[model samples]
Target: MIESPDGERTEHCGFIQKRGTNNIAELTAAIESLRRIPEGAEVILCSDSQYTLKGLGEWLPGWIRKGWKTASGSPVLNQEHWKLLHQEYLTRKVRLEWVRGHNGHPENETADQLANRGLTLG
Candidate 1:
């Protein structure tokens, strides 16, 4: 998570489940981070995954109305994480920022390391 002055903080958390890919992992992390934030705080989510950024930022509402199904009528991946994010977003202001992976931004790098370590330990 990235914390700034003025009581602002950015959180990014995820998990690598047995069948989960990196996209799912990143989404999971982002959702986890969102859950820990206090109500009414402004949060900026930085992620390298465009799928995540676009999915949550743009496509989520329609998907939710469709019961988390995709255009092809397939169930959406990572529904639990998506649901959690959706719920938390209802109570806060969240902005998703896309960052290039491995580009050496401090918080992104740190979050990446923590995510990888979480994978190993899990």
Candidate 2:
């Protein structure tokens, strides 16, 4: 979803791939959300996937430092997405917020439904 500083908002969902993981969906959503908003815009992104959140927020620096390899000597699973997300994050004012899913948070629930509906399109 994209929201203007003035409070105008938009929501979007789409398939990242025919075979997908939760992390991919989460990252795809976030990347698309960032792309939709204006450059240098201040925006808050919310997601339930800890993999996506921590991967980009907490673990990104080490991954980049290690040339995108994991601590266990494996390559990061979604290097391209991570790089794109990190690039946007560095170039834009994006604040990522974590939200617990299926806990009856109205917006979260709605987003879940939207994501589920997107599966039918694949």
Q: Could you estimate the TM-score for every candidate? A: 0.81, 0.90
Q: Supply the TM-score for candidate 1.
A: 0.81
**Predicted candidate 2 versus true structure: per-residue lDDT over 25-65, tens digit per residue:** 88887887778877887778788888878887899999989
Per-residue lDDT for 11-121 in model 1, tens only? 444446478877677777777777777878888877888888898789898898888898888999878877877788778788889999899977778887887767776
Candidate 2 lDDT at 50 equals 87
Of the candidates shown, which would achieve the greatest TM-score relative to the real structure?
2
Candidate 2: deviation at residue 23, Å? 1.3
Q: After superposition, how far is residue 81 of candidate 2 from its true place, in Å?
A: 1.4
State the weakest 10-residue window (summed lDDT) of model 2.
Answer: 1-10
Model 1 residue 108 CA deviation in Å: 1.3
For each candidate, what is the lDDT? 0.77, 0.81
**Highest lDDT: which candidate?**
2
* lDDT accuracy of residue 1 in candidate 2: 54
